[model samples]
Target: MTETSTGGKGAPATRRLSAFLYRHDRLRLAGLLTPPILWLVVLYIGSLGVMLVSSLWGVDSFTGSLVKKVSWSNYHTLFTEPVYRTVALRTLGIAISVTLIDLVLALPLAFFISKVVQGRRWRYALLIMVTMPLWASYLVKGYAWRIMFDKGGVIDWMFAPLGLHGPGLGLTATVVALAYLWLPYMVLPIYAGLERLPESLLEASADLGASPLRTLRSVVFPLLVPSVVAGSIFTFSLTLGDYIMVKIVGGTTQMFANIVYDNVGVAGNLPFAAAAAVFPIVVILGYLLAVRRSGALENL
Candidate 1:
């Protein structure tokens, strides 16, 4: 090994790395993170704070300003009103269902990509196609969902000849559409985790007289908990936040996101809209925190 010019011989690499970080790379890395940090602060955190404040207040028409009473009336209305309760439950249900179905579809597909399949270029191409829906306008995507679930739409036509009569424009269609849209999000995270699993470990499982199913149950699934949790979080949170797709494909009586939109836009009750937004955040955050605390996140 080569010695340094200094009396200390082994510090050359460390000194070079420290210099590079301080002089060149550190600032660049910080710059890269700044925009996203700004976005989180200005857009996400700022909006959430404003909404929280609004949720605490009451709207009065004659006063034409929010009453700073900081009461639970808004939340109380959410629980006491049957319509609100039903819609909220429906929203939560749809989010959970979407997350689960996407997980079911993604796990096998990711396993295939990681274990059964080769030629990653083609596989990645197909993965990109699945996420292409995200590139389109969210409104257009919702409208596309509307087309698929319309009475004379392709979904109905496909099942019509079989005498199974497709019931379009409702909760079921909304769930299916959300699942279809979020499935890619689930797949990407799972694929990442699956791809990173060691090949030799799988071989070892096979050597232990474990069938493919058993190996998956004991070995693969355990290692994939983190990926599953992450993917489920994305799917659930996205569906919970989505109103446009549900509104386009669903009936007048729908979920909480729709209810929030109605209150803000149609009902002109900003405080209630603010209150409605809290349900999804509270539920989603609570679930994610639970998962993280339960040792599931560490596996990732």
Candidate 2:
């Protein structure tokens, strides 16, 4: 039988490429990373830089046009205005509330799903149930919640027997909607972290005569801190930037995002909006810094 040359020139080509990559490590790394680096620099960082610069610039009230001249007036207004302060604080409060609510709800459910649940199929089913909401449209979810919060709606109907009523389109409704929207984000991370936890350690803790609560406090929670922080980063930042849900369910309550939108669209003041937009970014950065300080990010 005649021997056929398998792989033809593929082997030599692959070997040559491997040799070149090995010889030029920096070049290979740059080649691998250049696309993402370019995207970050050109899109994300560039947009942020533009926002910062525009926030510093002023609008010509006489001509009703943007002035290229740099000024601190917009930021000064953001600082000095009472409405701005109130809205900023309110938005911060709502974000914090959403994060806390999601965390409280996610922890136990994640533990149940990751540790207590038996069989792979059941575990996957629970995870799917947890994540299924995310497949729905964002606007659809918001509007659905809006309907539920409306007068004589599902929430009102449910609470009517208790001689109470739903928190009609307001801060509470907004927080509830946000928590519902972001809960999956919080759950998945904690579930993953919990699943990754060593069963042997848990066994050891029980063997060492630690109660369930004590074991969780002294072992599980400490290891889960990084995942919790990671999840909160998403929930907090998403809540901070969200304006649509608030618009739908928040009624007259204006979040920082709502204020920014009003300034940009109603007031026709992009510079002022840009300046106001810096607050959430600053707040999120501060949170990330706090998380880092606690060494959770290092674990991540």
TM-scores across all candidates? 0.84, 0.93
Question: Clashes in each model (backbone N, CA, C under 3 Å)?
Answer: 0, 0
lDDT of 1 by residue, 1-300 (tens): 234455455486788767877789768698779999999999999999999998988988686567877888999998899988787788888888888889889988887766776687978777777688889887787888888788889899999889876778888889988898888899988999887889888899999999988999999998988888888889998999898777788766477787788888888889988998999899988998898789866754
Backbone clash total for model 1 is 0
Candidate 2 C-alpha lDDT tens digits along 169-195 = 999999999999999999999999998
Off by over 4 Å in 1: 1-38
Question: RMSD for each model, in Å, please?
Answer: 6.4, 2.2
Candidate 1 global CA lDDT score: 0.85
Candidate 2 has what TM-score?
A: 0.93
The model with the greatest TM-score is 2
Model 1: which residue pairs collide?
Answer: none
